[model samples]
Target: MSIPLAVVAGASGFVGQHVVEALRRQGSEVRTIGRGSVADATWDDPGAIEQVLAGADLLVNLAGRSVSCRYGRRNADEILRSRIGTTAALGRALANVGSPDLLWINASTGTIYRDARDRPMGEVDGDIGSGFSVEVARAWERELWDAPADVRRIALRMTIVLGAGGGAMSPLINLARIGFGGAMGDGGQKVSWVHVDDVVGAILHLHRHPEISGPVNVVAPDVVTNAELMAQVRGSMGRRVGLPEPRWLLEAGARIIRTEAELVLKSRWVAADVLHESGYEFSHPTLASALAEIAGRAPRGLLPVALG
Candidate 1:
């Protein structure tokens, strides 16, 4: 049997790398397009995009600047431009193609939902937030929605993705190792998250389920609070205690790290309603089990120093 051809934009990213590997593992011929790779065509070249789309059975756009930094004006502009611009560019290329790809799965974020400490948000009834990150997500989705109807499109509103290498888990792991993985702020904010394996599985499921379209929350059914999340990290790392970070301290540290406190402060209570109804089973549903799987063994040799 011949393998399907997949064109993945921004496969170099943390999630994208895993997606590409998953595709290839499932017997798909994957071609990556990025600015850094001379072998692949760059996003600027409309001809390159159309060429890839023409032959591709799937088109996955994960191209965007990381939003893990302080949002100054210049940084904010780049963030918006990287997401919205790349999405628009891909739409134009898809339009020019002879036949649109079977499906286009563009990356979105669960942060698009408001800070709901009360209830879980889903695609049908989730409240969208305002400001830079929310605005970027809104506009990014618009680009995919406005694209030609020939291709089926689904915007994956992903939550905090946990894995071995990167995505939102690394820094937290490092912080735990150094004995600083504790609750931030009031520790009441909901932490909606998913394991990387589930992330890959969700993408594959979405690809197969042509009946599903639009925004779907890709998160584990098991949700945790900031306190519970840190507790799990501490337990996995074989630590007894962690120093809690107050809101003022969190704000100060974020400024020093050149990142935004909103990354830590905001409450993201999202649920995988679409995936649940689709009957997709999650491999690592609980936070503790997922952390243990990622850790693999007993974590030893702590720094003996703690951070506030």
Candidate 2:
């Protein structure tokens, strides 16, 4: 007979804001903890966050430096530090709290899985990849493992989240408009994606389903190839064609953009096996339909695409 109080760390981010809005829409009281916002407290004040968590039913940590930038020495270090530091800090805070019913949902990436061109990777059988991104993801989940024994924890191995305004969809839409939204690196790489709304829904579902824990794949049922993904973007934007970018060209473009080609070049064929087994139906299951919905709400602007 009481509404749940959800405390969202890193609440000012693109996904964080959407998750907060979704929680509020579901009649839950939301408190945010992050830097420079009117959160309950910033990361600098861990005690205040602990106080907030004591009264919370759910704690979702979406804090991390965006991996969309160029992975230079400085950037790469910060990327690792931000995720591990935030998760460790949250674990410390949770340790101080006495709430047994608290559920912590931390952000993990589907990129942790190897470049699986063979078949779709799932929670049970997916092979973990090595390298900078995969290492960061592994450490991120390790922090969660150190949390108190009483707390329930789940690491969302999220794929590329498609949404309006600030996600993979916006830049792809821009590229489609500019007639450069083409398949990269032979366009055979598999791209696993999920709608932002479904992401929110899945988080809530996991919160209610205590039977599920550990790293769960949060992607959609339908995964598309790089060529099909570009074609869908072009189709949604009313364009017929996109110039294909080869690996050499992608490397050059990545240097120019100060980012890596791995974001687009790597094959990430992931599936939501846990969610499917738990009976969680996706709101936007297919790439074409998901892109159409996002495109309708996407702002009309020529913002440069930063494929992460």
lDDT of candidate 2 over 87-197, digit per residue (tens): 888888887887778788999999999999998888889899999899999989988897654688899999999888776776788778888988989999999998888
lDDT of all predictions, in order shown?
A: 0.85, 0.87
Candidate 1 residues 48-74, lDDT tens each?
Answer: 877877778788889998898878888
| Pairs in steric clash, model 2 | none
With a 3 Å backbone cut-off (N, CA, C), the pairs that clash in candidate 1 are: 70-258, 70-259
Which parts of model 2 are misplaced by more than 4 Å? 1-3, 304-308
Poorest stretch of ten by lDDT in candidate 1: 299-308
TM-scores of all models? 0.94, 0.96
